[model samples]
Target: MTKMKNESNLKVTFCKRKSGLFKKFSELITLCGAEILLLVFSPTKRVFSYGHPSVDEIVGPLFGYPVRRVEKLMEVEEQHGKKINHDKKVGQDQRWWERSNKEMSYQQLEHLKMSLLNLNAIVTQKMLEFSNP
Candidate 1:
């Protein structure tokens, strides 16, 4: 009975420390904008982690501590995903446009050409309508 009680107390301490570490990890990530992954196994054989992409994806390749390229690729992937998700949410949603009435004026000639082509189509449509009337 004493051994069981000791084991139980140990478990409770382990759980509390694990939760505290997880919270600290999250806070560090939030404050520093660094990609971090932690792998912890308790005495009872449990796994825990905290990271942006994942602990394994970040840490497994170079035998712990991912190379700079890997971290950069992960960041790019995350940014791309965020952009795609934002586009999906903002597309056809006038609420976003209403909040930020902004447009990027940085233009490429290719984009300008496409815009001109669209304008031509609209002009042609209007001319056809007038002629028909």
Candidate 2:
């Protein structure tokens, strides 16, 4: 009976801590003008989540775990801006590979290089089609 009671208390403590962390995350987002989405699964496989704007919209992408779509869209806009201001491209946004180099291990660097090569191949194929047409 004592062991069962201790287990129940531990579960309650876990729930409270999770709720507190989510509340703090919400406050930070509000104060800093940021968007955040979080998903958590308990040991029992129950789900808890929080998202600024709406939980429904962010749900699909968090589950999929790609580089959040909104962030990618912003990067596209920044790249367009840089293209237009090619002569004065100071302080332009950095690509993912550029930003990642600071802390990347050697293995990660090699992987990133391979991914960049793949991206170049895809882009070159599209460019070839444009040129031929």
Candidate 3:
């Protein structure tokens, strides 16, 4: 099993493994002409999903999904576009140091280093507990 030292490391590993899994899933579907629907929930309760052809195509009808009209679909798309734009602007507005560690003061860097080490110890203990149980 892959081990994570801290929350940051865990998150990074999750993203990398998630992307790799999705790529493999895509290859499997393409090579075998298979339908695939995958849903994963992170330890933090966030979701990641991948579906071949379309998510709706595989899971919608079975659940008696509603067929949305063009107007409703368009509205949803507009809202999603707005959300994306807002997130982009927020990211762009963050201070340089907030986005990177290069500008951190010595004290700040030391604090962060200690915090990461503490987190690593906590996570390691939790993993041991889970494994023993």
Candidate 4:
């Protein structure tokens, strides 16, 4: 791709592209429970980032470790895809909340937290309505 010479055009493109990058990362992280640290700098040097849980949580492990992009991670995930789907199908057969917390993966636990929070809000709203009515 050629460098965008127009300053306004460059900034607009950067803004749009960074949003798309973060959206894809959000979807991928939600799908596979993959931890990613994406640090993006805009044309004006403003920082943009998105991290599941938190950026510190993902970055903390890198202190002693060397940074190596593992191609094997993709291959391993590809092989596990079918097994993961099968497991999820079986899991769906059982009532979801009935499953033990210890058996849940990180993403599952995050989902459970969000679900519980939403339930809490609904319960609180109902309680207020009932009391007022």
Candidate 5:
């Protein structure tokens, strides 16, 4: 009925719930011979996904998905990556948390947020003893 207020317990709960949830997904696929794609984003924006057979196989055609735009998108992403690589801080590597929000576009800002989320998830999961997070 209420969100868990304790951070330590909440993180532990997250790991347990994530494990049980993924196990159920696997069971559904195996028992029913189902084709399923699951994408879960936690409260911190960490990404977790499960796809049977494969995500591409189970997902439908994008319905007039722009292949041309995908090429352009890849090119843009490549350039962005190069920019980040070159924009290192004076004494240390530039981290997502260190980047200035004002310089980022809305999409970039979102990507930054997700990166941080993933990083936080990794750190939390690693710091804990359990294998799942």
Candidate 6:
């Protein structure tokens, strides 16, 4: 393994090494019937995963992780159904103008005004910079 001094170099090296490692793992699984689950977290905290069958299927059963029950699944399905119905009702109930120009609260209006002012100031500054430079 080559040592990398810089963050950019390290990230590049990590990607190369990770790809090689996964290739070897795949070969091992195909030739030797070895079950494998590999999980690597990058320097940026992004996850990289490789598994023979699947990461969850092998790890969950081996580690005695709790599997979802029928009741829990039903509850999730019910919640999703409610959300879909509510969304449909909301879309159906509102007219085009009502949906387009939503009535903002006093606080929301003030927040919007301030945001617009800040954006205007930034644009003015950029214009001045461009004109001068």
Clashing residue pairs found in predicted model 1? none
Please report the candidate that would top TM-score against the real structure.
Answer: 3
Question: Which regions of candidate 3 are displaced past 4 Å?
Answer: 2-5, 69-133
Which 10-residue window of candidate 3 scores lowest in summed lDDT? Answer: 91-100
Q: Let me know the TM-score candidate 3 reaches against the reference structure.
A: 0.49
Q: lDDT of all predictions, in order shown?
A: 0.52, 0.55, 0.58, 0.57, 0.59, 0.57
User: Per-residue CA lDDT of candidate 5, range 1-133, in tens?
Assistant: 7999998888888877986887798889889999887766676766666667643344324333233533454455557656765665567545543445576556557665554454344434433423343
TM-score for model 6?
0.46
Candidate 4 segments exceeding 4 Å error: 64-133
Model 4, poorest ten-residue lDDT window? 64-73
Tally clashing residue pairs in candidate 5.
0
Q: Candidates sorted by lDDT, descending order?
A: 5, 3, 4, 6, 2, 1
In candidate 1, how many Å is residue 5 off?
8.3
Q: How far is 28's C-alpha from truth in model 2 (Å)?
A: 1.0
lDDT of 4 by residue, 2-63 (tens): 99999999988887787678779978988998888776756785445555654435543554
Writing each residue's lDDT as its tens digit, candidate 3 over 1-133 gives 6677699989888877877787799889989999997877676865555666755455555554443532354355457545544554354543322334566556445544554344344334433554675
* Model 6: residues with Cα > 4 Å off, grouped in runs: 1-3, 66-133
Candidate 5 residue-wise lDDT at 24 = 92
TM-scores of the candidates are 0.41, 0.39, 0.49, 0.46, 0.46, 0.46
Which residue pairs show backbone clashes in model 6? Answer: none
